[model samples]
Each structure stands twice: as C-alpha cells, then as structure tokens.
Target chain A: MSEVNNKKLRTKDLIYAGAFGALYIVLMLILVMSSGMVPILYILAPITVGVFCGTVYELCVLKVRKFGPALIMGLLFALVACNGAWYCFVTATACALLAELIIFLGKYKSKFMYLLSFVVFNINMSCPYMIMTFNRDGFMTRARDYYGEEYANGLSKLMTPWIWYALVGFAIIGGILGALIASKLIKKHFTKAGIV
Target chain B: MDFDICVDDSGAILKLDPRTKLVMFLTSSVASLTCYSMENLLIYGIVLCVITILCGKKWLGVKSLLIFLFLIFFRYEIVTSGKGSAAIGGLLTSLITIFLFFFPVFMSLMLITQTTRINQFLAAFDAMHMPNIVVIPIAVMFRFIPTVAQEWDGIRKAMAFRGISLEPWAIIRSPLKTIEYILIPLLFSSISIMEELAAAALARGLDSGNNRTSYETVKFRAVDYLVTFMFIGLAAFFIIGRKGL
Candidate 1:
C-alpha cells in the first residue's frame, strides 16, 4: 500500500509540472501581449516569474509534492520580467529553495508545505527590501532623486512597514490560492488517475 | 504538442546568432521601460511596429489583421472615454505607449524561437558567459516537461477508461492509491533519463570545451548600431534629469 501511494504521488507530481509549465509559457505570452494595453498587468509579471520557478521546483524538486515551488516560481518570474532588482531574483530563488528543503524535512506531511510557502516568501521578499534601505545602488537610492535626503533617510519608516504588509498579504493569499487549488484538484481527480 | 507561435520557415534568422537578438531585445525593452509619455512612446512604437512586421512571414498577410486590431483597440479606447480633449489625447497616446512596449521585443522573441533549434539556443547561451547551472538545469526542465506532459495524457486516458472523473477538484480528492501507481512511474522514468543524459553529454564533448567555436559569429552590423543608438537616445531622454517620464 505504501509503495502504491508513493508511485501515485510521483506520477501526479510530473503531470502537474508539465501542466503548470505550459501554463507559465502561455501566461508569459499573454501578459506580454496585454502589457502593451494594460498597465496593471505590468505589476503581475515579476511576481509570476518566481511562481513559475517554484512550480517547476515543486513538481520537479520536492519529493513531497508541494505547491511552494509554483508560488515561488510565479513570484520570481514576475520580478524578472519587471526588471526588478537583482536581489529580488536571488532572494526569490533562494527562498523557494530554502522552503522546499525545509518542507522536505516533514517528509510527505500534510499542510506543512503550505505554511512553508507562506513563511519563506514573506522572509525572502522582505529582507532584501530592508537591506536595500542602506543600499545606495538600490531602489531607495533612486528614492533620493524623487524625495531628497530627509525622505530618503526616513525610507525605512516610510517604505518597509507598508511593503512588508503588502508582501505578506500577497504571499499568503497567492500561496493559499496556488496550494489549495492544486491540492484539491490532485486529491479529487488526479490521484485516482495514478498521477499522485 | 510542441506548441509555439508560427514558426518561421527561413532559418536564416537563427544564423544571425541569439546574442545579437538578445542585445537588440535588451536595448528595445530598456528603452520602452524608461519612458511612459505619449510623444516618446509614439517615436518608439512606430519603429517597433515596422521591425516586428519585417520579422514575420509577409506573404501570410497578417498586416491587415494587425492594423485592424491596433486601430480598433486604440480608437475605441480613446473615443469612448468621456474625458476632456487633453485627457482623451493622453488616453490614445497611452494606448500607443503600451503597444510600443509589447511590439518590438515580442517580435524578436518569436523571431528567435521560430528559427533557432533548442540545442542551438542552449549552445548560444553556453557560448555566452551565462552560468552552466542556470542554462543546463533549465534546458533539462524544458526537455523533461514535454515528455512528462505526454506521459500524463496517457495516465489520464487510462483513468478515463475506468470512468474516473478528471475535473480539477475531482482529481485533487482522488485517493492515495492513484498517486503511488501512476506518478511514481513517471518520476522514476525522469530519474532514469538523467543517467543517460549525463552519459551522452559527457560522451559528446559538451564538457571538453576549452576551444569551442561557432559556424556563425555575432557581430555588430551598421543597422544594429543605428538601432542601438536610437534606443540609447530614447532611453536617455526618459532617464536624464531634465525631461519627464
């Protein structure tokens, strides 16, 4: 019975990976197509890059069969496409990797991966942001141009609090949506299909 | 299906070298990103539209469809808005501005993807100082994804034969037996492939490359320099201290 269940999980993970990878490619093209016409979609692209990376990583990396890879992949992809900071790329990738390794410790445990995804994305996305406060080559560096020294000096107070809240909100909501939707689908239909 | 947009028949574009295309794309994408205003975006958009159209199969006669979509979308957005004239003008220009951002680089992406074989694409990146870790892993991922996708279809069909429901939620709830049987086999297949891949890449001189060369070298053409300059000018206009975005 254990062997049978393991096979099913492996198959399901592969199928999900291919499905999401195609979805990522299409989403990329569609976003690029719409990027011309829609400004809001611009914001969505950087976030989705990490989500794609995460998806690939989960379906391909974590033997536990988690959705954390997809979330991180989506978020990373978005950041890269947006030409966001170099740190965003490194942090996003590192976060997903760290999350997967941590969740791997739980060893096929339930609901642990979901919490892992949320926590990792929050820490990963926010730390670089705080680090950038002193980063003269950073976005806050550019802030000085628009807001001057007083505004720049107070940037941590000005930006960090708000951005952290926003990052946490997005990661939790997006991570929940990704994991729940994937888990529910896999459990109901794909599991029986021998896709585990 | 190895789904992609229309593949260009002339593989000549591939011969041009991906590094060249990458540079072009970087210039154009950066230029577009730096500017948001109407006048600058128009200048960028016109040049992009022309370049994009030139990249594809002209005889397919997509020109009419392209123009029609461009006009209808732009015109209706501007005309329908109940804003004042300046605002209306701004809206229309905004539409054009958006178009510019999408048009050129997308053309260049399609151009390369259509012409270049996957092996060559990887080889080109390999030629660049791009790290093997990034290139090699991503290549393996793309190659595995399609094979696994096909395997998945087979598993799905097998399930459907047993009258199993395949809806998203339905699949999610299916029991543990299904996972162990179908997915593990595919996972094992993927692992098995890696051994062969390692052997093959090792055998094929993929690793012994202190003296690698290409059939075609990417060099800066006059037109490339011109295009690059134009992009630099536009980007500078947007980024420089005096002018507005």
Candidate 2:
C-alpha cells in the first residue's frame, strides 16, 4: 500500500484519467444541459452533477491510487465545463487541490477521507454562480435588460448570499449521497468483476 | 517521366498554429466571461464563427451562428416581448440567457476541437514544454470524445434491444434504475477501452521518457502571430474597455 502511494503516475494512469475524465465530463454536460433549462434545476446543478459523477470519480481514484487523477479531472472540468470563466476555473482548481490534500493526508486508503474530499471537491459547482454573488448588481442589471424586469427580479431574489451558502450545503449533501452510492456500486459490481 | 512536386493541400484556407488556436480559445472564453452586453457578445461570436469558417468548418460555423442568432431572437422577441404567460416566459428567458452567455465559449471549443487535429495538439503542447501530466490526458480526451459518442450509440442500441427505454418519461419515472442501467455498461466498456488505449500508447513508446519527436512540426507563422495578437487585443478590450461598453 505504501509502495502504491509512493509511486508516480505513469502514462497509463494519465490515460485512464483522461478516459474517465471524458466520461465524467460527458455525463456532467448532459446533466447540466438538461437541468440548466429550468431555474430550480439550475440552482441544484451542483448536486445533480455530484451525485451522478461520484461513481466515475471513485473508480478513477481507486484504480489509480494516486494523487494526479483528481487534479487532472479538475483541470479537465475547468477547461470543458467552466466556460472560460476565470472565477470558475480558479475555484475548481482550488477545490481539486484541497481535495488532493485531503486524500493525501489519508494516504489514499481511507474511505472516509475519499468521501470527505469529494464533498469538498463538489463545492466547485457553485463556481458559475460566483459571478452572480460577487457582481450582483451588474449581473442583475444585465439580466434585467436582456431577460426583462420580472425575470431579473426573480433572479435577484434567488441570488442572495444565503442562497450561496445553501447551495454549498446542498452540494456537500449530494456528494455524501453520491459517494455512498459509488461505494455500494463498487462493492456490488466492480469488486466482484475485479475492475477496481 | 516527370516527377511532380506534391503540395500539401488540406483545404484549410487559414492554417493558424495550434498555439494560436489555444490563444483564440482562451481569449474567447475570457471574453465570454467579461463581455456583458448582448451586442458585444454577438460581435465576439460572429468573429469566432468567421474564424471557424476560415479554418475549413463552414457548416459548423454557419450552424452555430444560426443557433446563436435564433436564441437571441427568441429571448428578445418571443420571451421578453411578454407574449406568453409569465411562468413559461421566465423559464424560456433564463434558459436562453444561459445559452447566450456561454455560446461564444462553446463556439471556440468546437472550433478548436474540430479544426485542430490530435497530432497538432500534442505537437503544440510538446513545443510549449508542457509536462506529460498535462499533455497526455488532454490528447487522450480529444481522441476519446468521439469514441465515447460512438460507444454511447452502441449502448443506446443495446438498451433498446433489452427492452429498456431511455425516454425522458421512463428515465424520470425510475431514475435509479435508469442510472444503473446506463452508467454500469458505459463504465465497463470505457474501462476496457482505456486499458487497450494505454497498451497501445505504451507500445508506441509514450512512456519512453525521452524527448519524443512527432511527424507534425508545429511552428508559428505570420497568420499565427496575427491571430494571436488579434485575440489578445480583443481580450484586452473586453477586460479594460468593458466599463465604457
């Protein structure tokens, strides 16, 4: 176990990350695109993605048993899904780094640590909304002009600071649920098949 | 017999360097984030679409432009005009707004992925002296997206053969079963595919840890410089001149 922890990520590991990362991105894109249509679902987008993507994340981390996959996954997510928003990019990378640290502290063997890291990593879902929180007035005025008064008003009511907190809270809960589901699936199928 | 000189004719009218494409992608992404006004966003989108067309993706450029224009029209004319009920109009407005906001980024993404080849990306990243950690995964991803799409089609067919419906109504009715059915097979297939890809890559000496050479040589030409500066100028304008606009 220690030897595995100390080993550097090989080219194959990187390829595996790319493959799973692609799957993760595709799934997240479908989830986000489908849910992004409605306002309520858009608000819960992080949770939705977290719940669905946990299985991929868990598989990649467990298979590689290394540090780089999560970081690579974060970078891929930032590049693919963040829409070039610098804030989102920064937040996503930061969350991944924090997750990496947490997982490292656990030496990649602790299930509790992996779950905790995922919960932390899932906070990146709030990145797209960060601009809204920071530039509320600017975003609202633009929304008002483009989307009109009532739409802007409704958006403003939903863009409060407390809502951001609630979003983070919901993301953590979703991560927990997702990690639980992933663990069950891993035990049920992946372990038996010797894939993990 | 006269020996004829073979000219490399790839049909790309404007062959900008991959690095230039990277710059364009980043600039467009940053511009999408900073440029708030609809008119400005439209201009940015049009400029990118024109670039995409010049890169030999005429249909893609035209299609993206049409969709973007239609979204803008729908938002302003139909939804914002107060023709429908408040509930449905608001929903449509928000949806369209999100699409509009990210349209430029998506356009640039498509532009890069479709116009640039995997070898070009690898060669460009290699020239930029990026570590393998960053380069390999990205190259693999660019190569894998199409494969994933293909696999997804197969999975959909297999599900249908098994009498499993992936319709929205069916999925919503039993979400967990739907997830289990779709995700399990996809994961299993993808894992196998990755193993094969890794073996192939290793056999090609990807893990050789030497300064690898490539058949495609990436270099910056006049067009590359022009495109790079143009995008940089646009990004600067978006960031600094955003206030006046």
Candidate 3:
C-alpha cells in the first residue's frame, strides 16, 4: 500500500497522459461538434462523449497507474473546452479531483473503482450548460431576443430541473456502459498486444 | 493551408512572449463570454483579428473575420426576418449564436497554437515556475494535437478506400461500425506514436530532475507588457459593463 501510495508520476507517465489526453480530447471534440448543432443532440452530447471516450481514458489510467494523469487530462479538457467559461474550469477540476480520490481509494488497482471514478468524471459535462441555470433569466432573455421567442421557449422548457436531473442520470448510465466497453477492449486488444 | 504549430518568427510582424499570448487568450475568452452587447463583441472580435494578423496568420485572421461578419449578417438579415421555415430557421439561429459565442476563444486558441512552438511553451512555463508535473504533459499535448490531426487525415483516407464513408447519414445509420472502424486503428497507431515520443523525450534527459535551459531565450518584452495590459483592460471593461446589455 505504501509503495502504491508513494509512486510519483515520472516524465514517461506525464507524456503518456499528454498523448492519451490529446486522443481523449479529440474524440470528445468530434462527438460534441457533430452533435452540438442540433438541440436534442446537444443536450445528449455528454452521454455520447462518455460512451466513446472511456476507452482512451481507461487506457491512460491503466498505463499510468497513478493519480496525476486524471487531473492533468481534466485540466486539459477544461482548458480546451472553456471557451471563456470559468465554470467549466472549476467543474472540470472538481470532478477530476473527485475521480482521483476514488482511484486512490482503490489504490489504482481496483477496476471497479476506476469505472466508478469515470462515472463521476462524466459529471463535468454538465458544466457547459451550467450558465443557463446560474443565469437563467439573463440567458433566456438573450436567447429570446437572438433566437426568437419560440426557440427560447423550447430551451426554457428543456431547462426544467427534472430534465437536468434526468440528463445526469442518463450520463451516469452511459459512463457505466462505456467503462464496461473499455474494460472489454483493454482485455481483448491491449492485453493481447502487450500495450497495457 | 499548412497547419504547422511552429511559425517562422523571423517573418512575424509582432513577436510577443508566449506568456503574453496566454494572457491574451484567457482574458479575451473571459471578455467574450461575459460580454452582453453586440457592439462589445464586435470590438473584442476586431481586436483579436488585428492581433492574429500581427502574429503572421493573415489568412486565418481574414477568414475568421469574414465568418463572423457572415454569421452576424445571417442572424440579422435572414434569421430575424423569419423568411425560412420556422424549424430550420430556429436551428440555424441557435447554431450561429453558439458559433458567435465561442468565436473569440477559438481565434485566440488558433493564435497561440499557430504562432508559438512547443519549446517556447516549455520555456514560458518554466519561467513561471510551473511544476514539471504540469509542464511536460501540456507541452507534449501541444505537440501531439497536430500529429493527431495528421493521423486522422490518413485514417479518413484509408476508411474511404475501404468504403467506410464518414458522412453524417452513414454515421447515423451504423454508429457502432463507425466507431469500431475508426477508433481501433486510431488507438493502435496513437499508442505506437506515444511510445516513440516517450522514448525520444526520455533520451533527451527529460527526467534528469535538474534545472533545464532552452535554446530559445524566453523573456517578456515591451510588446508583451503592452499586450498584457491591453487584454487586462478589455477583460475588466467586459466585466464592469456586463449590465449594459
């Protein structure tokens, strides 16, 4: 336990994090950009990203077998996706910290714990939409003026508290499914190829 | 157009420090997000366009400005007029709004990535006394984004040859196959690339745990100070003027 706890991330681990982090981000950007144009898909972008990005992320965590990589990857995501939103940076860091804590609890060996951490990590996807909730009246008024009253009405309808709750629930389920797929892929491909 | 990360600073009209560019990116992004009026957005956008052009990315600056103008035109002349079908008009309006909302940050990102090299970033971070833990990964990530783009291009070509069209309709029809076809090869190739990169970096004494020097001398110049103050001022104005909308 001490040995596991004492291991620091070397240069190699950091590089691996960067490399895999890039891949994860690229995958996420592809998912989000493709889905973002449509309102419903935009709302569901987190689930799609969660489903696809787990493989790359799980691979990074397993390869690095340390705490810093998750936080680093989260920081990278926050930076890339911030788009001027400070809340994104805060949410991403907090979620990544939570993920790291979960992994630490498992001493970086429990596969289940890794998957559980990923579920929490997916919560950061809600960050981009947070402004809508935080400044609801301002957002709605702007939306109404810019996009017309109908569009604003639709958006406001979607912004109900229960909808956000449901979206979060769906995202968690997507994370679980994604983690399972990642574990299977790691076993089927990475382990056989000795990459893991 | 060539998308190389390293620009030839010799031809650059304005050579600002990486630190200055970073501050500009952060401040401009904050300003753009908090901004409430179209006039403020235009001012912020024009300032960024000028900075981008000065940084030697003339085509990108011009292209982004054109896109912004076009979006603004569409939003006002077409979308607001409500000439098209309501559903399609609404979708287009929302899409254009999102694009306008994020345009400044994307432009700043392009400015940073297109102008500054990885070594410059490392030197800047080092000067700031950032831990190696944070510095190495970011540097590597910066270097790797272009490589990933190149790899994705190659993969797309291969997929096309194999009759795996990445068109929206095709992707929507069979998402699983699309993922299996594209992701597997990409992951495999990326792993190999990561290994090579790690090996090369390690061979260069990346883990020596000593103070490292760089070939490029990184220091804040007069231009950097000017740019920093300008962006800080813009950000403050945006925040203070938030209620003006």
Error of 2 at A165 (Å): 1.7
Q: Which candidate's lDDT is highest?
A: 3
Give the backbone clash total of model 1. Answer: 64
Q: What are the candidates' individual DockQ scores?
A: 0.10, 0.58, 0.56
Docking class of 1: incorrect
Instruction: Compose the digit string of candidate 1's lDDT tens values, residues B1-245.
Output: 23243344452322344445555555555544444444554565555545444545343225533663575466446545746665445545545434444554454444444444446546777666675434453444344444555565676687788876656466458633443445445444554454455556556555554544555444546765666566667656756622332
Chain A TM-score by candidate, in order? 0.49, 0.90, 0.88
Kindly report which residue pairs in candidate 2 clash with one another: none
What lDDT tens digits, residue by residue, belong to model 1 across residues A45-76?
Answer: 33432332233233333333553434434343
Top model number, TM-score: 3
lDDT of 2 by residue, B92-143 (tens): 7777877787677777766666766767788889898999998989878766
TM-score (all chains, Cα) for each model: 0.54, 0.90, 0.92
Q: Regarding TM-score, does 1 or 2 come out ahead?
A: 2
- Which runs of model 1 end up more than 4 angstroms from their true locations? A1-22, A28-57, A63-80, A84-94, A97-111, A118-164, A189-196, B1-6, B9-15, B27-29, B53-56, B59-101, B137-237, B241-245
Tell me the deviation in Å of residue B20 in model 2: 2.2
> What is the descending DockQ order?
2, 3, 1
lDDT of 3 by residue, A93-149 (tens): 898889999998998889899988888878777666676766666667766755566
